[model samples]
Target: MKYIKKYHKYIGLFGCLLIAISCFLPFIKYSILNINETNNFFNGDGKLVLAINIITILLILFNKDKTSLISTVSIVVILIQNILTINKDIISIGKLGYIHFSIGFYLLIAGIVICIVYPFLPKEKNIS
Candidate 1:
């Protein structure tokens, strides 16, 4: 449980950085290079990835007892979105596209693992 929480924290941090890069860099490249593929990647499913990143940030920020329910709900929504996107080919499979698919898959798996292990973690006792 401790390890899961630790990894989740670190992974979430990495996710933030990846989202920032993925959202901005390609768009900037497209503008400078006048490339259609870069623009297409950003304008298409990138929007969905950005939305998921926002939700993930919210979930991580509100992960304590008061917001645990919301965290769980957000995680579930993310997982469902991942499944649907993968099925619909919104998440592509290739050298150039594998990063997005990999991140989505890892996020879904990590969220589920965290949720499963969360309940077994030790709770704080109220001090009188």
Candidate 2:
């Protein structure tokens, strides 16, 4: 826990980096009888990732309590969006494999979790 508190910000930053990189990675791929396509631009969670990234910046700029609450809300929003997509089958990976999960989505999700956890870290104590 102490180590987590000590490095939570870094973790969050790494997550944000991952989100940015994920934007360029192959998010989904599809193939059909005569054509194939992929979505790497922002992918499925691009907008959400953008939101998380912005909120992460806010978390870093603000103090505790407020940051914590905002972080929690951000987490909720990401989860909600993920859930909604799952329930609605928004991506459509149909019989033709219209869409498929890619490395980008995994990286994006990892980054989001890390960012969300950062706000709950314990503040560093002054040894001096």
Candidate 3:
């Protein structure tokens, strides 16, 4: 249980870093091989993605009392975004889209897993 808790924390933190990169990579122009152009998406309403990422990070970091609530909300937002993107068929279903989709999907799954396993973790004793 302790090992699982530790790995979960690490994985969540790592995912947060990836989310940050995906959120902020746009707004800067740089040509790199295999990396798709993100500036176009960033120019539009895609900024909302960044906003959600920021909010999710904060909620996960400070959600001691409401972990399940926060996780549920985060998962729902990610899942909705993925569904909308797929349904609209806007972005090209290529390498970049795959990267984006996979990351979002993994984040949602991780949040769900963490929420489910959270109760199994050892609780901190309150010392008076």
Ranking by TM-score: 2, 3, 1
Across 47-115, the per-residue lDDT of candidate 1 in tens digits comes to 665665566566555554334435445545654764575455433433333223434344445544554
lDDT of 3 by residue, 58-98 (tens): 65566442553464456456556656855554455433343
TM-scores of all models? Answer: 0.38, 0.65, 0.42
lDDT of 1 at 103: 40
lDDT tens digits by residue: candidate 2, 45-84: 6666566666766666554434644654665576467657
Which residue runs does candidate 3 get wrong by more than 4 Å? 6-8, 24-46, 63-75, 78-82, 90-128
Q: Which candidate tops lDDT? A: 2
lDDT for 35 (candidate 2): 76
Report the number of backbone clashes for model 2: 0
Q: Answer with 1 or 2, whichever has the higher TM-score.
A: 2
- List residue ranges in candidate 1 displaced over 4 A: 1-67, 90-100
Candidate 3 lDDT at 83 equals 61
